[model samples]
Target chain A: MKKFFLGFALVSLLIAGVLSYFASGDPDGLDKTVEDTGIAAHAQEHPFAGSTFADYALGGDSKFTGLAGALGVIVVLAVSFSLFWFLRKRPDAR
Target chain B: MHMSDGLLNAPVSVAFLVIAAVGVGFALVKARADLDDRTAPMAGLVATFIFAVQMINFPILPGASGHLLGGALAAILVGPYVGALCVTIVLVVQALLFADGGLTALGANVTNMALIGTATGFVVAVALRRLAERGKGGLAAVAFVSAFVNTVVAATGFVVEYAIGGAGGVEIGKVALLMWGLHALIGIGEGLITAATVTSVAAIRPDLVYLLRGSRKPLEVRS
Candidate 1:
């Protein structure tokens, strides 16, 4: 079971690290809808616009998208795993 | 879809934020019943996978692309309560660290993708449990339909939010129609990816699939 999970996590990390670089840079559905409807003009830059890893990259550089994505996967995994660790029901209880 | 901070008005944003907080809080409490040694790890892995797949935006139309929302996939695999937590965690992380979703609009995003998306998907998955337990193909079909509907329903959530307090000159009707059309196309991609992933997971270890817990198809080997 551990091996299966590790393999699954490894594959996910690889996809985020490698294939994410090849993802289309075009606007997503919502963005494109807003743009097409001309409502995009009303969109505001989020407060996190100046975040260190804004737009899923280091310094908003495209070259580091893969690295950024991989880091995000790790962070999300760690956070979720830790959260569930405390939340999970112990067998001895009921 | 990750909406920016500017898309919604402050009042609407705050309202949705409160709604998201309630929904996520409820899920946090409910998730305890679903999480055990096996599913705790499974839920964590599902969340990581969602974060990873969300980065791979596939082109759906001329200039529009879409990515896996993962609501249905997560719900089917780990049960809806834990699934909602997984998605909320990803959304919160993305808003805070990755700048993927807007900080102000985080509540709306969570409400749509985490609460609405997972709830609808889980409902559909449960409704089709018999078919989903038939075989891998059956499960994939159920996954695809649930995911497809999840995307569309989640997109409709945005439309509803926009109708309530949209601060733009665009016609509400236009927003609704375009959103539906675009999301329909995006949903197809979401469906395919979800089907593939769910089928693959069910094939290897059916025990991990929450929706398939009582199915008579695959024999579970206790590890």
Candidate 2:
């Protein structure tokens, strides 16, 4: 059962990573509205813009970027699960 | 919507972080009361489902594509606190790992999509459920309205941020109206999916649905 859950999470994360890359880079509804109304340019640059993972890509080829993206999701999920699992008190372990 | 870093003014961004922190603090307390072994797994599963559903983008008009925000859906299926936590976790993961949203913008994204969206949606759901007397159909309606409200609220947040840190002179009113109108349409899609998902969960494990508390009518009255 645990393996099944883990497998499901892995597959979902991979799909999410790939689809995220394909998501419309064009301003979304909010962005479009902002642009049309002339406030779109008001956005400031993030202080952390120089970070390696600043954008979706990590300064690599598209395929390589996609793989990195997928791995990132897996790592995040694993870390989150571990934190929650550890914090969780066992019925008697507590 | 994932607002990337440098998207909003520092003050506005910092303000949102404060709001998000309060909401998260509240959620932590609430979750402790509501979460059990079963609820924890259910929340995790719901998060995964949200991740999947968000991938299927539907065209907004001719070219623009928008996907499920999942705040309302998560809040309704699980308790509000847990729902907020689930969506926030997803956003955090997306930002740090996938770089889907900007790292610096993580706080703003969580505030808009997770805190404001979930709180507004949950409130709407509660109101709608009360009006409908907990009828099965009521759950669907609540989900729809909640999702719609959340999207609108998120859009409004963006407008406010722009007003504070606009690049140059621009009309805020027009921008607000335009964003609000387009998001209303996007909200419809969010609403439908949330309603559908909530209805499905209510059908199978009605008990799992947090928004359907005392309102759930007896399936069959004792003779």
> DockQ: which candidate is best?
1
Candidate 2, B88-186: lDDT as tens digits = 877876666455666656767788788888888888877776743455577677888899999899778777776876445567787778878888888
lDDT of 2 by residue, A1-94 (tens): 4654565476667665666666554556765765565554665554544556545456534445455556555554555455345434356652
lDDT of 1 by residue, B57-113 (tens): 999887889888889988999989899999999999998998788888999999999
Off by over 4 Å in 1: B217-223
Q: Locate the minimum summed-lDDT window of 10 residues in model 1 chain A.
A: A43-52
Candidate 2: CAPRI quality band: acceptable
Candidates' lDDT values, in order?
Answer: 0.89, 0.69
Q: Which candidate gets the maximum lDDT versus the true structure?
A: 1
Score every model by TM-score. Answer: 0.97, 0.80
In model 2, the Cα lDDT at residue B47 comes to: 71
DockQ metric for all predictions = 0.84, 0.32
Per-residue lDDT over A1-94 for candidate 1, one digit per residue giving the tens place of the 0 to 100 score: 9988998899889988999988988888888888888878888877776877888889978799889889999999999999998899999975
Q: For every candidate, what share of the true interface contacts is present?
A: 0.83, 0.28
lDDT of 2: 0.69
